[model samples]
Target: MRISKRNLILGIIAIILIIIISILLIKQFSKDEKPDIKVDEKKQDTLIYNTNVEGIANINNIYIYGMHLNLSGEVNTTSDISSIELVLFNKSDKKRYNLEYEYIDNKVKFYLSNKINEGIYLDEILKGEYQVLLKITSSDEVIRYYSLNNNTAYSYMDYYTITRNGKNNYIEISTLSTQMVIRVTEKTLPKDVYDITIDPGHGGDDPGAVKNDIYESYINLEVALKLKKELENLGLKVKITRTGDYNPGNIAGISPYGKGGRVAIGYETKSKLFLSVHSNNLPLYPQNNGVEIYTSTNNNKQLASLIASNIVKETKINYSSKKQDKVMNGVYVRNFTTSEINTFKREAKENNYKFYETINTKTQYYYVIRETGGIITGAYVDGRNKDYSANLYYNSNIGLDGYLIEMGYITNSNDLKILLNKKNQYAIAIKNAVKEYLNITN
Candidate 1:
C-alpha cells in the first residue's frame, strides 16, 4: 500500500468535490424552492450593514391596512442620490423584492397599496418573513437601512392582513423590535378574535339627533346590534362601540376619537374595517331623508358605494337628498371646507391652543373617519386640546378603514318609519357589503 504523495492528494480532492456536489444536489431537490435574487451577491452584501446615518436616513413610520402599507421618514443625506428603492429582504433564502419609492425634500415615502396604484401588491409576493429596508443608490455610497421603528408604531404591531383566494394567506406586520418585519404565513385565523368593529354613534348622556318620542341613540344601537349579530353569523368577528346605551370612548362635547371612544375602539380591536352607525337629523329641512355613507375624503371610496348601494337596494331607505357633501349616488366625504378651516384657525387662536397643520380643508371633519385613518389619511390627534382627550392611535400607520352611515333623517316622517322598522333589513345589507369587501365565501 505504498502510494505516491501526488496520488493521495488527488484522492483527497475528489472526495471533497463529491461532497460539495452531493450537498448542492440535496439543496436543489428540497421540497421548498425560494425565488432567486437577481442582484449580484457581492453587491447585495452591503445591504445588511448597520450604518447609523441618523437624521440623514431614517424611517419614522410604518402603516399597514389589509395588504396596503405606507412608510414615511426623512432622508437628509448630502450625497447625490441617483435612485431609491424599498427593499423587502428575506434573510432565510436571500430573497428580496425592490419597490419604487418617492423621495422629495429629504422626506421619504413608500406605499404598498394597490388603491394608490403606485407600489407593490401582496398578491404578487411569495410567502415568507421579510424585513423592510431602504436602498439608496448615490454617488458616495449605496445606503441600506432597516425601516426604523418609531415610538408610536406599536398600535397595529400584532395586526394581521388575511387574503381571500384558492388558498388562504396571513400577513403580520410587526415592529416589536428595532426594525419593521413583515411575516407572511399561510393559515386561517381564529374565529373568536374580531377584525371588524362597528360603532353606534351617540349614547348615554348624549342622545344624537333626538326627536319627540324617538331617539337616534336607541335606533343606532338597534341597527348596530343587529349588524353585529349578522356579521358574526356570516363567520366574521365583530366588535361594537357600545353593546347597550352607554358609550365606550369619551362622550360628545369631546373628540369622538378620544381614548376608549368610538374611533379608538376600531384601532384597539385592530380592525381591518369599522362602520359607525347613526341616524341623521335636520330640523331646518324636515323633508330631508335617505341613506348617506361617509368615508375619509383622502382615502379610497370603494366601501362607500358598496354599502350605500346594498342599503338602498335591500332596505326601504332612499338616496339622500341632502347633497351638501355628496361625492356619489349615496356616498359623501364631509371633510373640512376652507371656510370651516378658517373659523377653526380663529377659534384656535382665541382659545390659546395650537391648531394642527394637518387640519387642512382636506382633513375629515368627523373624528370617527379621520382619526381612524392613521398616517395614510392624515390622521392627527396629538393632544392639543385641553378640553378633549387625545387620540392614542392618531399617529398609527395601521388604522381602521372607517365609514359613517347616516341611515335616514329622523325628522322625515317616511324615513323615520323605515329607520325604526326595517332594522334587520339594514343589517343584512351591511353584512352583504362586508362579505363582498372581504371576498368571503361559504
Candidate 2:
C-alpha cells in the first residue's frame, strides 16, 4: 500500500501502451476483412429490327408492342425512359399513325395498329420490293434515316391491260401505291377454226345489207355456226366472233359497213390461216350464186390460195376473177394485207400475183386486199372471174396456199339451200377444201 509515486506512474504508462497496441491490431484486421468491388468489362449492346440494318432505336434493350409491326433490340444505357414513340405511314393514302413504344430490361418494343389499305397492298407486296421511308427521332431533336431491306411485308394493288402491234402483243401493269407502270410483250397466234372469229356483217342498230327478210349479219352468223361444227368434226379448231345473229358493237377500231363490222377470233394455233366467214352482197344484181374465198393480200397469199382452191375443189363453187384491190374494211384482213403485203411485195416480186386483186375494171381499190396488204382471191366480184382466181389470191397472201371460200349467196334460192343443207355437196366440198388446205395427205 505504501507504493512509490514513480512506480504507480510506470504502471499507468504500461497500461496505456497495451491499449494502443490493441487498437492498432483491431484496425489492421478491419482492413483485411473488407470485400473488393470487381470492375465490369465494357461491352456494346446490339439493337436489331426485323433483321434490318435501318431500324430506329437510340438505346438497346427495350420492349415495344405495336399492331401491324414488331421490333427487337438490346440496350446499354442507364438512362430511365418510360416509352418511345414510333410513327408509321400508309404510302398510298398518305396516312400516318403514332405508335406507342414500351421499355423493358435492356429491350424495346412497339406495335403499329393502323388498318392497311387493300388497294395499296398487292399480292406481290410481301416480296419486299417496294420503297419505304423510315424516320426515327427523339424529343431532343436527334434524327436518323434507315432504308429497309427487302424483308418488310406490305400489301398492294395491281392493274393490267393488253394490246397488240403487228405480231407483237403487250401486257401492261400498274400499281396504285407507287404509281409505277410495267409492260410485258410477247407474240401470239389465232387458236382454231372452231374458235374462229365469225364477224356478223352488222347488228345492234347497224343492219348490214338488208334484202327482204334476209339480213347479211344473220346469214353470216348462221353459216359460221354451221361451218364451225363442220370444222370441229374435221378435228380442226374453230372460234366464232358472233355466236348469235347480233353484233356486240364495232370492235374497238372497226367500221360499221359489212367490211368494217366483221368479227375476228384469235387462235392459239401454230397455223397462220385466218378464215373470215361471210355472205357476199352486191349493189347491183342480188342474183349472184357461188361461194367466194378471200385471202390476205400480204405474205399469207399462198396460204389463202390453198384454202380457196381446196374449198373450190370440195364445194365445186365458181371462183371469181383475181384482181389487185384496195382494202377498206376488216381490221385483221386490212392490217395483215398492209403490213404483210407491203413487206412481201418488197421481198418477192415474182410472187406478186399471189396477192389479191380487185375486180373493179375501173379503180384498183379492193378495200380488204388493199387495206390488208395481203393477197386476196377465191370468189370473184363477177361471174366471169374464174374459180382459179380465188386460188391465186391465197397463193399470194399466205405463201403457203389458202383461200376465202364464200359459202353461197343468200340472194340465190339454190345457193341458200346449199348453204342450209348439212349434207349438201357444197358442204362436203368445203370440208374437203379445209383438209386440202392443211395438206393432210391422209
User: TM-scores of all models?
Assistant: 0.70, 0.35
Deviation in Å, model 1, residue 355 alpha carbon: 2.0
lDDT of the candidates, in the order given: 0.71, 0.38
Q: Please identify model 1 stretches exceeding 4 Å from their true place.
A: 1-61, 71-127, 131-156, 162-181, 186-193, 251-255, 382-387
Top candidate, metric lDDT: 1
Let me know the TM-score candidate 2 reaches against the reference structure: 0.35
Error of 1 at 75 (Å): 11
- Expressed as tens digits, the lDDT of each residue in 1-442 for candidate 2 is 6879999999999999999999999998777655321111111001111123244333221111000122222323333443333322222313233445556666544333222111121112222122233344555555443332222121221221111122323223323332222223343433321212333345555566566776767665665566667666665544554676466435443432223232112211212233555566564655666555554433323334554455456555555332224232111132233555455455445543443344323221333232211222222222222332222222122111123445556666665555455334544455565556444433
Error (Å) of candidate 2 at residue 205 is 3.5
- On residues 1-442, what C-alpha lDDT tens digit does candidate 1 reach at each position? 8999999999999999999999999898662444444344434444533344233235565556544565555555555666666666654324443444566775555434334212444544567666666666676676545454454535245445543443445666666444655667776655533568898888887788888978899999999999999988776667888988776664555566666677767776667787899999998899888999998764567778889999999886899997699889889988788999898788878877777778787788787777787766677743356447477766776667778999889999899889888999999999899888767776
Which 10-residue window in model 1 sums to the lowest lDDT? 110-119
Full-model lDDT, candidate 1 = 0.71
